[model samples]
Target chain A: MARPDNARYQETHEWGRLEKDGTVTIGITDFAVDQLNDLTFVDLPEKGDKVTRGEAFGEIESVKAVSDLISPVSGKIVAVNDGVDGDDFSALKKDAFGAGWLIKVKPDNAKELDKAKSLADYEKQLAEEAH
Target chain B: MQETPLRAEHERLGARMVDFAGWYMPVTYTNIMEEHRRVRTKVGLFDVSHMGRYWFSGRDHIKFIDKLVTNDRAGMKPGQIRYSLMLNGQGGALDDVLVYGAGDDATMLVVNAGNRPKIWDWIQRQRKGFVVDVTDMSTDYAMIALQGPESANLLNKVSEVDTKALKYYRFTRGTVFGEPEVLVSRTGYTGEDGFELIMPQAKAAYFWRELLNVGESLGAGPAGLGARDTLRLEAGMPLYGHELEEHINPLEAGLDWAVKLEKEDFIGKDATVAIKAKGLEHRLVGLNIAGKRIPRQGQDVLRDGKKVGTIASGTKSPWLDEIIATAFVPANMAEVGMSFQLEFPGKGTRTMKPEEMRQTALVVPMPFYKRPGKK
Candidate 1:
């Protein structure tokens, strides 16, 4: 799978990208979506909700299991993707890094992006974990 | 882990395997949703060899089984099949099983895989005064099910058996695929026209591959345990561990039709009689969720804000395109159209609204997706 060049990745498989404004776009990685098999439900945090870094913001359920969606960066939610919360989630599978973005957050600290892994580093981490 | 005769073939087909009841079996050949949809609309083959099979025979075989099971076995004719429950002395279910009468002096039991050893030991301990001998036949034979609307037509193209004439819950010993003698029974867990075939373990793989070859041309493909579960759940079939359990009585589990209360002395008769007189405290009912979120087993069932019961078996119904579940609630509260809330515990946040996390459900009649002519 191709990791997007514009996004910074977290160890827990979430991705965050700095926008033109002070806000950031966040979503789970394609690798995470693949591990979940078929996505049945994506519970997203409400807009204006306060989120802390490395904490769970919502949950995602597959047919067989449920997983927590961990936040990659601490911020205030500026926008939420209502389409992803709807019945069909094929868009999430088809474009994990593009239209599948879960939420937009106004970051508490923009420098937190420095701690996020680059595309190459995230791919390397995934390769190392495969062993 | 134990492997079925078709285990290697499943792996070669790129099936996703999982450990199920000590056996390495295919949970899905491809995607679960696609496989589930295939069985609902077309035909699908399933390898169910992991279930425990046992044979019983002697002068006292019929008498012993009649005394042990909750269903009447004395009136069963040769080649008849009946679904029954074996209960403990407390009227709790031991296991729900299918009793097949091979003859007046012989019978067979097909039981759940996880409870095979326990059921064997329980029956054997009660055989001291009987003349019957119980033999475990699980390894000697392998089984497969061809299920869906097109099952009979698919089988007719490959087998000599008169598939169209076979009645539901009846079996015939006949040759299949021109190979060897096998027992073909018109029975299935999915609410569809189907057949379960039992053959010698040595010939199982050969027949499996042959069936797939012919069946594929007819739009039939190999399904797996994942599809099997969704199909059965949509059909309102009770799974052993989920709906039926050691402490769950058959009466409360909505299996009163299988329990013969007036039959000559049987296990749990006294307890069942007393319970019947007093009426049941709880009853199983089907819940149809209004929206998309699927309720899972062990989730709390509530009325208003108070917990009323717990979910037993639940699934996202591929046929209905909705979420359906089976739960036990107070007998008085189990009427159709009764509303309730399924409370799924939020994992991370205590900040989410209670209404946001819970899904509304209503009680509905069971066998949720029953096919026409499925008695």
Candidate 2:
């Protein structure tokens, strides 16, 4: 998959893209989706729910198992994606980086984005893990 | 990890291999959801060579087997398959198995791969006085199951057997893909019209690829253990470790049809009769999740304010589009429409009482989804 150059990734397989409006959009990475087999249901936080970085904010269930969706950036949830809570799961598998963006948060600390891994670094980590 | 005859074939098809019961088996060829849906609607092939296949011969084989299992096999004709249970002295399950009467003096027993060694040892230890020649044919044969509604037509195209004429629970020896001596049995664990083929180990890969080639036009795909589990669960079939165990009796597991109490005597007959007379303490009941959360095994089931049972098997049903589970609870509380609280995370804290728990599951009928025809 073509990784977006501007998107930053967390070690736990979540990706965060900082928008021009100072809010960050978060979604699970394509690798996470592949590892999960097939995404059946995703539970997302309601609007205005506070999300902390490195903590579980919601959960994603696949056909075989369930996993926690870890937050990449800490902030108050400003907006949520309808697809996450809805029945259509194609977004999570097909357009994970774009239409599948799960939640948007107004960052508590803007400097935290620097700590996230770049697209190249994230791909390298995935390659090493596969070996 | 031990490998089946089709292990390389599974890897060639990009299967996700896992360590299942000490064997490296395919968990899924494509994705579990797609494979599961395909089998329910169409046809799918499963490589079940890892399951133990044992053969008993000699003049006293039938009598010897009748003394060992709970099912009545005295009237079983040649080329007939009977599902039965091997139990200990306490009526606890040793393993659930399928017995096939090959001829007047010979029989075959197919058992779970995980319980193969234990069942084999148990059978051998019990055969001291009987004049039966026991042989472990597990390593000598390969087993494959073609399951679903389209299985018969798809199999008829590749095999010499007239599968359409074969009745349910019937078997016959025939040629499949030019390989002779294949035991084609019209039986399956999936609640659909299907057949199982047992043949030589050397012909497994050849037949596996050939069957897929012939059935490709019919939308028959290679399914793995993942799809197998969901299909059986939807069929209300009890898995060995999940619904049965060394302590769980056939009566409580709802397998009374296979337990012949009216027969003269067999292993565990005395205890099973006693248990039947006294009634059951815990009954295996189906639980349908009222919410989207999955009911995981070993999760606490609460009634009122106390834990009443634990979940045995659960999965998200692709066919029903709902979460379903099987659990053992008090017989009185196992009635239909009875409600129980499932310990789902984020529903509430543990200190919350039963009524306070936000998420609840209802006791529903088993076989969350049934196929069109009756078995």
Candidate 3:
């Protein structure tokens, strides 16, 4: 899947999109979902939880492995995606960008996302990893 | 890392390759769940050439083997295969192996991939006075496992061998794809009735493609190590590094049947007898967790907020659709109906209390998903 140009990505494969309300939506990239195939369970932080940039906030468990869900920006989580955290994962499996957003955080500083990689830069990193 | 004979074939199939036991092997073709389901319901092929294969010959072959392994190999009929464990002097399991009684003079042993080097060295050191010639045929021969309920039908359609006549744990030499000297055995790690084929390394790719071509309509496709692990775990088979280790004995691993104490003077017989007489301190037990959280290896098994044991192996069983695991707990707590807690550490850097992050685990019967019509 082509990454959205408006969003910024983390080297760990997380994406953060800034909304008009100054809150940033967070979710893992399609490459991450593909790598962690057959997800069995997902653990997300609760609403009002604090998240630090480049830190693990939660975890994602697949059949074969367990990977941490890294935060792209440091902030206070205003909302958590109940749909992804619950038993059903159809929304996360179908669309990881829009419907599969894990958490919405009110950032301490919106400039924290500036350290994230752009779409072109993230794709380049993925390409190099492929080789 | 070492590459198998079918490495190119795996790459062509777009397999997700990983370094397993110092060998470049495929972990999955697509996803583990799909491939695991295919094996349980239909059929699946696996490239298992990385496992060590050794051929034994000479007059004292059986004698040498009987002394090294724990099983009673003296009574094994021709073409019979028996699972056995090789233990150190302290009664700790060195490696679990398969002993193939090819004939009165010739025998074969298949060892785990990770322990190939260690076992090879052990065998060389132990063959001192015995007049047995052991040849490592791992590179010269390639192994493939054809598994599932539809495996027999698929094998019958492609090979000249009458798979229907082959009894469980029995093998036959035949030709596949017009290539001669293929040894087909009715044995597998998975609980399903399947076949393990050993053929020349040079003909591996050709035979693999031919089998897939003929078996495709029978719902046969290549499965990778990921599926193989889940399938075996569901079948309640113990893996080497997880359940069996150099410090873990077969008796504690729930593999007592494979360790024959009645046999005369095996390597670890005295220690095993002592262990049996003194009674077991710890035992391996199957566990079923309450939720979807998987209990990974080395995770603490808690009882009353205290560490009581360690998880040996665990996974979200694809067939059973439950969180099943095996753990080494006190023998007194190894009975069914026993309940414990599996501690899951918080992923965040912040410290959390033990009681805050834990899952309920219950002791349950193993062979979690036995194949239909199997006793």
Candidate 4:
């Protein structure tokens, strides 16, 4: 999945693409969706709500089990992409990079981005996980 | 404690392996929901070799097992099948099983995976005076279940043997995939119409590959124990350990129909009679997700802030799009349309009323999802 150069990934399989405007576009990674099976209901965070790093923002209710969506960065929910709520689950399969985007956040601090994994590092990390 | 012939196949498919009744088995392949949705909408392949099979022979064998099981096996013709239970001396279930009257003296008992040894011993003890030979064919045999609406068509293609004559709960033994020792039974754990194929252990992999190849056009997936649990739960069927055990009687588990009170004799009849006169305390019933989360087995059942019983098996119903569970509730609360509260994560106590009534799960029996008739 393609992303902005400045974005980072969480080891738990969530990705955050930090836009130039200091807002970050967030969604669970492709690996997370596969691990979760068919996505049935995604509870997106309300726009303007606040979430903390490593805390649950909402939940993604898969048919088999429900998993909490954690915020990779502490921030106020600036906007949530309506695509997931719009029922284009094929996005998670087709254009998971762009159209499958979940929520956007204005990070509390720019340096907090350092806590995430780089693209090359995340790929190698996923490789190690594959082994 | 032994794994099925598909252990390597399961691992290759990235199945999440767990110890079920001591046998290391795959609980899921890919994801449970993925497999479950595929089964509901399409077809699913199941490796069911873990179940135990016993063949009974001798003239008295018919009378022997008929007295043991609750089903009216004495009246069954060859190729006919019946679902029944083996009761203990006190009328409690030894195990819920499928009995096939292969011939006048030829009877077969398919038992649960966990209770093979115990049930085998029970059968031996009962055979003290009867002139019969009981052979444990489980180790030598393997079983596969092709479940879902399309399963029948897929299985029919693999074998030229007549299937149109076969109705529900009937069996016919013949060759499948060039293997001569095949028995196709019109039965399954999944609610969908399907067939269970039994073959020798050595020929299992061959049959597996054949089924996958032919069933590919039918949209069959290698379903694991996880999706099997979800599918069976949706059907409101009982799991041996969770929904049934020696400590619990069939009456409480809503298996009273399997108890033949008029039978000349069987284990557990006397106990069941006594218990029936005394009345039942708890009734096993289906509980729709009382809250945001699903109820798991062994979780305490509550009524009026007091403990009543406990949950046995549960899952989030893909069809219902809600958490659903089966629990043992007080006999009174078990009535159709009864309401109760269940504790869930974040959501403390939530009271939800059952949407239906109990009648073969038709009323409040909690089928949870309405389904069309099979092809």
Residue-by-residue lDDT tens digits, candidate 3, A72-117: 8899999988788735678887899989889999999999998999
Candidate 4 docks at the CAPRI level of incorrect
- Name the DockQ score for candidate 2: 0.22
lDDT of 3: 0.89
RMSD of each: 3.6, 3.7, 2.3, 5.9
**For residues B232-257, could you state the per-residue lDDT of candidate 3 as single tens digits?**
99898999999999888899999988
Which 10-residue span in candidate 3 chain B carries the lowest summed lDDT?
A: B348-357
Q: lDDT score, residue B4, model 4?
A: 94
Which scores greater on lDDT, model 2 or model 3? 3
Q: Candidate 2 on B66-175: residue-level lDDT in tens?
A: 98899978779888899999999999999999999886868999999999889988998999878889999998899999998889889889878987678999999898
Model 4 chain B scores worst on lDDT over the 10 consecutive residues at B347-356
What's the TM for chain B in candidate 4?
0.92
DockQ of 4: 0.12
Q: Rank the candidates by TM-score, best first.
A: 3, 1, 2, 4
Off by over 4 Å in 2: A4-12, A16-25, A46-54, A72-79, A104-131, B347-357
Q: Is candidate 2 or candidate 4 better by DockQ?
A: 2
Q: What's the TM for model 2?
A: 0.87
- Model 4 residue B206 distance off true place after TM-score fit, in angstroms: 1.5
Question: For residues B1-375, what per-residue lDDT tens digits would candidate 4 score against the true structure?
Answer: 589987777777777677889888877787777787778877888899999999999878988987788777888888999888888876677799999888686989999999998999889888988999999999789899988888878877888667788899999987788777589999988777889999989988878777878888889888988788888888878889888888788888888777788888777778888888899887888776533445557877666767777888767776566667788887777887776666543210111123211111101565555457642
lDDT, model 2, position B153: 83
True contacts kept of each: 0.18, 0.18, 0.41, 0.10
Please give the distance, in angstroms, between residue B374's alpha carbon in candidate 1 and its true position after superposition. 4.3
| Candidate 4 lDDT, A1-131, residue by residue in tens | 45445668888778887788889888887777766665655656578888788888766655555677777889888887777752347777666667888888888985676788997788788788653
**Poorly placed runs, candidate 1 (over 4 Å):** A2-26, A29-35, A52-54, A72-79, A104-131, B344-356, B373-375
